[model samples]
Target: MSTPSKAKRKLRDGVADIASLWNSVVENHKGENPALQQRNLGMISRVLGILPHLVALMFTAYIVWIARPGSSLFSWHPTLMCLAFMVFMLEAVLLFSPISSVLRGAGYTTKRQWHWMLQACAVAAALTGFAVITTNKYMAEKQHYTSWHGLLGLIVCCAVNLSVAGGVSVMYPAIVFNMPVMLLKRLHAIFGTVVFLGGMVTMWLGLCSTWFTNNVHHDAVLALCFACPVIVLLYVMVQVGQKIFRRRAH
Candidate 1:
């Protein structure tokens, strides 16, 4: 029998440790498929981990197409637009790789979460900006449309933007690495505030227009804008509340 190299041995041991932890903490989430069980990360977990980005990419493409020059979208500077797109592409590469999987096994520190949040922000901003551009184009095309396609597109775009913002708040809270705990916590707190404020402003605009002008589509758009802020606020509040309660009990 051939002996395995030292590096191979270390790699095997590391993977085994991760597999053991998965079976322990994750419990029933670990699937029964033998093939998956044998893998470093289970098939389902890997897919679920990557699922968010896959959805992000699809939305990214849709928003880009709608916002691109051929459509009624905003006129963007060529250099800045290319830079933004490149940034998103870079984010995708980082998020979907084996490196991310390795990081998960290593456990996420507050610093890591902060870094992750920053990367996610770049992705979200680029995407949300695209959505806003697309909407602006639709508005420019005409005040009204005879067919429902335009209206439907607007609704979908708004929904996607809100979803992007909300999901970003969720995942971003845990992406930074290698930072001082105190600093990380402060940044986390600050980011939550920023996201909440931005979401609220977006929602307010939609609501005011809908309420005063009787804008039906604006009402739908506003729902997404409003929901993103509310959901993230509730999530952070609950997390903070739990921590406080635990501290009091301790």
Candidate 2:
């Protein structure tokens, strides 16, 4: 085996970069958000940066806990949607985190590309999960599109697909249409927000669906799993809206 120097360097670089980013956000927001500034910068940075992943983890853990041994292969539907698609999509949305000079230096366009990449992965995951559920339903002799979850999933998938198309199309307003780029971007942002909110609602519905309620006996854990992400995502969605329209409004 070769020396671990390369891996070490990458890891060291990553931590250092994150530290620099954290400090930048702290220093930039120090005067703006006094509550965060007064607290330990390290703690603030970690929470803001790491909270999304932790939320994803807890969401998946609850599903795994519910779907442990002997659960239907059908469980993969909620499992994949929650852990892979919805959570990943939320992270992509949050990538538009608070605007700051630190973020500007971090490459605004690069971050947007990352957002696109994450959403693309999420779409693929959703398609896979859709196939799993559809096949499972067929095997189980269940009727096609019988439940609220099924209906909602279909609607959400269409909305997400359309939003994604709009998102991409808006990037080239001149090529796509004669419309102004700003107008196209504003429209894309609206659809994107709608799709995100819909994703959150659909996931919550899936969690509270008969599958989870019947399987997971733990009451508090279930409640916590549902509440935390709902609250967090809603808050993030609001922040995103303000960031988007606030600029447009001005």
Question: Evaluated with TM-score, which candidate comes out highest?
Answer: 2
The residue-by-residue lDDT of candidate 1 on 124-191, one tens digit each, is: 55455455555665767855423343343344334534544444444554544555545444444444
Weakest ten-residue segment in model 1 by summed lDDT: 77-86
Off by over 4 Å in 1: 1-41, 70-190, 193-250
Indicate the TM-score of model 2. Answer: 0.75
Which lDDT tens digits does candidate 2 get at residues 1-250?
3469887788799999999998997677757665655576657665766666676677777676677623667767777777555466776776777631124356768878877888888888887788888898899898977777688887888888898888788766656757877777778877887777777777777777776788777877778878865765765667667877787678
TM-score of 1: 0.33
